[model samples]
Target chain A: MIEGRRAALPPVARLGDAALRLVGEAGAMFLFFLEAFGRIFRSWGQFHKTVRQIYFIGVKSISVITLISLFTGMVIGLQMYYALAKFGADGFLGAAVSLSLVRELGPVLTAIMITGRAGSSMTAEIGVMRISEQVDALRVMDINPLGFLVSPKLAASIICFPILTAFFDLVGMLGGYLTGVLLLGGNSGVYWYRVSAYLKMSDISGGFIKSLVFGVVVCTICCYMGYFTHMRRDSVGPEAVSQATTSAVVTSCVLILLSDYILTSLLF
Target chain B: MQANTPPDIILEGLTIGYGEHAVVSGIDAVLPGGKISVILGGSGCGKSTLVKHILKLHPVLAGRIVVGGHDIDTLDRRGMHCLRQRMGVLFQDGALLGSLTLGDNVALPLREHTRLPEKDIRERVLSKLGLVGLADFYDYYPNELSGGMRKRAGLARGMVMDPQLLFCDEPTSGLDPVTAAELDQLLLELKKSFEMTMVVVSHDLDSMRAIADHVLVLGAGRVLFQGGLAELEATQDEYLRRFLDRKAQERSTPRLTMPPLDQKMMKRDCGKYLDE
Candidate 1:
């Protein structure tokens, strides 16, 4: 019956319907994020759960973040060295690499990588729990499912994102040093000097702020998608869980880039 | 701790369903306190949906559900939590937290609601697990256990709170005959031992006959019958009689209309490998 009704609608009406649904969903997601965020402080016995989440979301992510950041910095160092050498300005390779990473690339790339690694798993795990009635079980037990599941994740993300971003920035600069000074025979002293000279407290703080925002955004969107897996109109059961995980990863990445743009404009 | 006289669950013209679609409507019944009341129905007849409404998991689309003198719709968040703390629910598949051991799963409510010492909590958890004959398996995770074991573990978790009211959703649906009989016996024993109001939703006639003091029969989007098990068994209404007698409605078409497999459709057939 719903399919028949939808089929009878004109193209314009269907478009409007879709737009309205999008707005409604956005509102729901915002409210879900608020509730989960607020529950982080209100719920009891969260320290252990938050610690467990930190180990999963932060500690376990160290190797991947290290690998990605190193490669990204090396690529930047090599590119900037060639570009600067044209003008005998290779001494500034450190400035270019450090500035770009500390200001933009570090936080953005780390968040995107974490979204792929941990964010997708969060959605899949919670989605399975929702589909299997484990979430409902929590509700019936007088336990707020958000507090029991999502809030600890939110708390862990808030703690982990900035620390990881800082780690990424440091490792990424070392990667630049390895490529520019060690591999390319650039002046090591000049590279180190340029890195320290160009960076400021604002640049580092800006990156941290961006990481914090991205962490909240990714965690919220992923958890929200999973929490409402049963309500997805496109699928049901295990298929719905798969769809939710995919949607969570894609949406978190897109939102990361989009918010990075917005925050860059405002912060810089 | 059980109430001296557990409060009855009263549903007045309750309409239960998913959003914008009513599964069962005009459901009026009383699940008496301290008795095993079974909500009996076949698949998709809204037995579970009715239970969800009564448990306040789903909002009633119409009318009211009063549990233990509290109107569910009128209850605030704190009130709802307070009310839920007094109730326990065993989901069909146990619904144990995958990350926690069986002991921790049973110990969850105690840890969450009370500031009991770890030693006392562990002791109580073991006792509940023992009641379900799973004390030896307290270290096991939900995935490690068989379906019957999972259901029993779920029962243990449900009873850990010592709730005044307990709800079980198809507790024996997927179990084998022996396991199902064992669960039925467990429910009977629990009822005999505690003055708890028990609401079990199932279609198992044998189990109902074994334990149900009162039964609410639902079908085709409404309540079909609501009374004692004896009255339901003696029911002369055509549909109820057919249901009680385990009779399937006659179908005009053949049950399996598809033709037999065609070997020609197979990509690879090693018919020669089989004995003629």
Candidate 2:
């Protein structure tokens, strides 16, 4: 019994150390977020740089967003059509598909996709810059590293995430129509009419709000991870950057899912 | 401009390290104007940490750092920025922004800090690059250049604003002998031509011998020795002796044995000196 208890429970000092580390990490993340946002109004001089980031994060993500959303919508429509067909409620297919895409899948999938696509890359790029001492070089130059390096990324993500989510919603709706009305021999008029009837402004607005918050969360976490990753003495070389990138992606994804549940509960 | 001027940097009772772990402490020294002061140490002896304290990269746990007559700990944000404007740092790896071309990298400070026109900025960039022997390589990327070329480019970037004080971290660590000597000559020329005060952190004895006017040796979180190279060479300090004569193999003879000094003869007459 004693051995089991020992195995189950770590030492009190180790637990305290872990708790303290978590608190420190939280404090650092909060300060970094505050600093990044604090510089927004003052970073107008970096307008061109922010634009470039938007292009890189938003514009470059269009094709993948479209492809993923369309396929997701088609799968949802086909499944819902067959499921509703059992009850002679085939006309409800559009409402089901559209609601699922806009209310939950659109924003969440967009965020996860971006976490995989751009967020991990941001972490790796900044991690490389950090280990290479380019970040210190900026500090030496009398430039606020947060303002010069991170704020642009934050602003770009916040502006792009909502737009990308909107694109995902639009393409998803179209894909639902293709699968439900044309392919499955459902009445086109009834399908779209039910979709238009059931989908409210609240649903769309909730998705947009979630996308914006997710954008902030993902970018802030990724940026913090990359900026503060002190390469360990034993774990030198390119693996450090890879480790940070993986951590950023995983943390962003888990936070997105957790926050999604909270937002859904509140918004509903 | 540096002639007969006060020291460019002063540290008093300084301690540096991360939280709760002091790497180097009790560092009281002055880097005089228009001279190259070398901070020399074996690896992991807090040389870079001391330099960082002067650069204001991190907080000093105890003591004060005065740069150009301004106390660093007391500087507000704007004051810190102004102080930084007067100094330049050449990192060990050059630390050029990989995304920008060499010309753009050199012109980064002026573009960010000054309101110079495109034409003037271009001219200055070219001139600085020319000084560093990277005139034709302005359009090249950092990855395209060799290590020595990158260091020179970083030097050009450092000199773009005509800084009064410069800090170089391990400027000769990974260069060939000829290239290292050339860099030393270039540093000598810059010191002469611009009258810049330079604080160089190095372990390379050859580079230190070539350029150092003052040497501060650090070890075990303290200043082991601080003086001219000749004075260091003349010292009998065992650690300094071992470091200076590092290339020699271990002696087969067990160790030196010396006769003990007479206690009465070695004792200082503090009473007489104090009374006098």
Task: Name the top TM-score candidate.
Answer: 1
Residue-level lDDT tens digits of model 1 in B1-276? 224668799999888898899999998899999899999988999998988888888888999998888898998999888889888899989999999999999999999999999999999999999998999998989999999999999999999988889999999998999989999999988988887899999999888999899999999899999999888888899998998899989999899989998776779885666536
lDDT of 2 by residue, B97-201 (tens): 999999998998898899999899999999989998899998999999999999989989988988888899999889999999999999999999988899999
Q: In lDDT terms, how accurate is model 2? A: 0.89
TM-score of chain B of 1: 0.95
Q: Which pairs of residues collide in candidate 1?
A: none
Residue-level lDDT for A97 in candidate 2: 89
Please give the RMSD to the true structure for each candidate, in Å.
1.7, 12.3
Clashing pairs in 2: B24-B221
* Per-residue alpha-carbon lDDT of candidate 1 for residues A159-265, written as tens digits (9 for 90 to 100): 99999999999999999989988999899999989988999889999999999999999999999999999988899999999999999999999999999999999
| Residue A59, model 1: Cα distance from true site in angstroms | 0.3
How does each model score on TM-score?
0.97, 0.90
